[model samples]
Target chain A: MQYENPKIPEGINVTKVHPLKTFAILVSGLLVMLLVGAWLLGFGGGYLASKIPYSQEQRIADSYEGDAGLEQTELLRYLQALADKLSQQMNLEDGMDITIHYVDEGVDNAFATIGGHIFLYRGLLEKLPHENALAMLVAHEIAHVKHRDPIVSIGRGAAISVGMKLLLGDASPSLLGNAGLLTQMRFGRDMETKADQAGLVAVNTIYGGVTGALALFEILDGIEDNGLVKSPEFLSTHPASENRLDELREIANRNGWSMDNTPVPFPEFFNRSLLLR
Target chain B: MIFQILLILVLLILGYFVGSHLEKKHYQSIIKREEMLRDIPAVASKILPPGSENFNQVLVMGNVTISVDYFKRFLAALHNFFGGRVTSYESLLDRARREAILRMKEEAAVLKATLVLNIKYETASIYKGGGKAIGSVEVLAYGTAMIPKASIDAV
Candidate 1:
């Protein structure tokens, strides 16, 4: 038996390869590369794109040059004077004229364009539960103008804009269909945050503190429970809502601004507009 | 009474459609391509070959501006709706940009330069209304209207 077993050569051992481990390593490496690539692309694109200069002052001056289609109606004149007064108090650059138009539709949206063009959506106008809130929104948008946020936004959006145009063409509704909605989702959230901060500063300079800003946020928060498509627009654009509110409170505290201690002239604006209507 | 309520609803719906239609019509008339292009400077006319200007550097400015009243603004707020084609706004911006470029081109022409370098742009928001919707979007587009500096003499 010994002799028979004799020449049993020592068995050569082969370790079994674990397929899962190999796959995990490969997948992990791939994920790491993807993260690195995305970071590189986003920041790299931003830097390179920013270097392609775009001017803000020139655009504003040009915008004001054309026919500003509003007749000097009493209302128009009043609004213009009010805006000018505010601008002067705020020390906005000279040669910038503020224009106002009245729309009958309903929606809450306000925006500022280059060259001192401000649009107040009918819906937004109607929702001014308080005048200060309205002032806040206006101040915020104005701040954006002051800080040249629009120009910067345009620049930041340029890359995405090109890609979007290539993919979705002009933001035309018919061409947009469902796809355009998806494209809208692709906007950078960070830009909105920057606008919020800048807008706060602008409003603070004008209104004395973050009260107006907070009021706007409060209004937005109150409306969030409402089921509307655009209700989330502000929130979605400006993220970390709680944090922003806290920051606003801090800003108010530092600036000696009141948070709900006194009477703001809401009725005056409301009653005045009512009489005009 | 039921019939009356239904009738009121129908009228409201109809009014909405009619109002939207009227708005669209107003925008169409106000944002005429011809008028917008007219804003372009003569300098642009000289440098931009007829067709080239149409596709590029052609600007349009709107003839009308509207503001969403406070009540309307509240409605917009519920929907968070802010802007539209604002075709008029777009046209105005487009024209302004073209005009600026034209001016720059004219300057270049005087300098006998073909290319205008170092283009820049800017925008500002003017607020109106006690507390309501936006009035208009004033857009400005400015870019260096380039031609070789030597080409300036040809003009």
Candidate 2:
């Protein structure tokens, strides 16, 4: 009997598919799966979150409220007064209240958080050319509050986290880790455009026109062009083809809201107070 | 966050270059040594030949441990999510088994064995707590070497 160790022909046990080709296919497939999953789950999460009682959400928001004892300074009071006016124009539901907080930072950003808390940075506030633009800014955040976008985003974020944890087998399942789920305020593009249109409505109601309001988008666009604002991650912002200014004008035209009127200047000392410190 | 992304990119590039180079070199060496040592026949048979009384049986074994690179590990993790054949580990196991067999044949050659019989393989995967930890495998090849009694006496 003959006994020999023949070289087992190559490619029998191993796959011939190139490793890089496999990598590309697998990576692209994963990305597409994740995007689709996020979209479907985001809407599902937002729907379930919307069903939650507004009072329960407010309580949840209050539990995480350690805003370092925000002082009721003149600027804060003025901003809050403006937010109140915007809230009235926006016709938020009863028991829903808007609160404005002035962040003494140079970042050109503004955002709304849970429990109707809107943070306005000095850098952004100082850049506004007129009262209508400032109102537009304030109203945009208040519109987010009115739409309960903060809670929707929180719900979406939590749903995505739960999905990931199920996949990853999270070792630690602590309650506190999810206690403050409102840490992120990433609203979807639809929410943002809805808020923009609602904010324009408020500005149109308050000033009888949207003369200075479009400047807000102009200033924001300029800041974006300068790459000053690093947008939050995982936010699928609107596509570039839908220019906000043009869209806003279209909304204004559709609603018959005047697009031009004498712009209202900022209150005396508003600039000085913004420039202070 | 940017720093973390940059770190992962750097690790992937390093893993690809180093891992590919090492695998190529290891296969080349294994091929060269396999040809040189093929003269000592190894088989998976339990029975001896017709004139079997003149030989001494010696137990010979060879084992190898191979680690996975970051690139392959990441690929395998992706495969785990998608539920498909984990092709990334195919080359690894293949290399390990062949290398182990070559080492066993080399041992048989050292004993001037005419043939090795009843060869078998034992395989193990080394895992550490499962959270993004690098993976490794160990393969052991063992057989009985049939060395002529005359050669044993000469030794």
Candidate 3:
């Protein structure tokens, strides 16, 4: 009850005095810290984050290392050949390298890792009915590489990476968790869309390139509608935007690339390859 | 009364120290997300030739912040000199990291990079040990916001 005495009229205003005043002061300080902290963490972090370099080749190499499997090596070779042909057609610089890996397992998936690495799932390769579609796929990925889309995506990642390193002092193991993977995936999606546009343009420069984009979309649409596999990594990596696909078609049409009757025969190479075996 | 006052002061000091110590965790998660971003490839922006205006809108995510309410609970226990749940901090930490990432992308948009890649974060203590008397917690986040060289050059 003696503490209550301080609140009485005769007593000095303790609430206006030391301890309570200290509390108010502390609270004010906390608010200022929050405001400043938000700015530093948000805009300041973003500003500084844009400066880091996001290398394409290095990221592809790291992805390969992270999931190094024997099956992917062959796929990588096949993709490399495709990239070379597309490069030649697009008149890409001679020094540009395209590497492709074919994984053995049948998962309808393909991912164009930044740099020149293209991973094609066995299931996805099995599904393609024409070389045009395959060309479209490769062309799109190459576009990402040419346009430096991967580098931009990775730069965003680099900003986050630098931030984490500073906070954890290079020792925290939390980077191995699902949260880590999602952050990478989220940023990767933007690059996928950019690559699609770029890929279309590169292919369209040649006569039959536009068909590739359309055919690829048709294949993807069927897969999504059927709900065959639960979560295909390719679909997960590059989210299919209906609007985006329509835009691609519109772009192709605008360029006078039409759906002509000259059907691209399914390559006999598909039958010759013992991929299912 | 004197002993009680001494006891209360001691408890408050202890609580302040513990609260600040626990605050370090949220900071750690924010940093971890940055590291993950760095591991990925980053590309430069390549704006479509006709539509360059979209490139001007930059979306910046503020520093990943755990809820003040969540942090308030942690601090409350400090005032009471009683420890509560530690796992309660995880969600807040996660929320902050996610927000930071989203903000990074927005910033990239404004910067006109096709991909904002290779990001990392640095954390600083907003309030350290000396501020124990008036229990407060604060952390500063900073990271690189990268856009592809191609896109940046294109613009």
- Per prediction, the TM-score for chain B is 0.33, 0.94, 0.40
Off by over 4 Å in 2: A1-8, A26-41, A61-82, A102-107, A162-183, A225-242, A267-277, B1-12, B53-84, B122-155
Question: What local distance difference test score does each model get?
Answer: 0.48, 0.84, 0.54
True contacts kept of 2: 0.74
Interface root-mean-square deviation of model 1 in angstroms is 39.8
Who wins the DockQ comparison? 2
Alpha carbon deviation, residue A217, candidate 2 (Å) = 2.5
Name the regions of candidate 1 deviating beyond 4 angstroms: A1-103, A114-116, A161-194, A197-213, A228-235, A240-242, A260-277, B1-155
Residue A269's lDDT within candidate 3 is: 53
lDDT of 1 by residue, A58-112 (tens): 4533544434455455545545554665566555655555555554446555666
lDDT tens per residue, model 3, B1-155: 58977876776666545644654564465445545443322323332334334333333334543433423443443434434233333333444544555456545546654533234444333434674433323233233344445565676
Tell me the tens digit of each residue's lDDT in model 3 across A133-209.
Answer: 78787787676656555445544455555565775478345633333432353335666777777777766666454
Q: How many clashing residue pairs are found in candidate 2?
A: 0
Candidate 3 global TM-score = 0.47
A115-154, model 2: which lDDT tens digit per residue?
7878788899889999999999989888888888888888
How accurate locally is residue B74 in candidate 3, as Cα lDDT from 0 to 100? Answer: 36
Best of the two (2, 3) by DockQ: 2
Model 3: lDDT to the true structure: 0.54
Candidate 3 chain A: 10-residue stretch with minimal lDDT:
A1-10
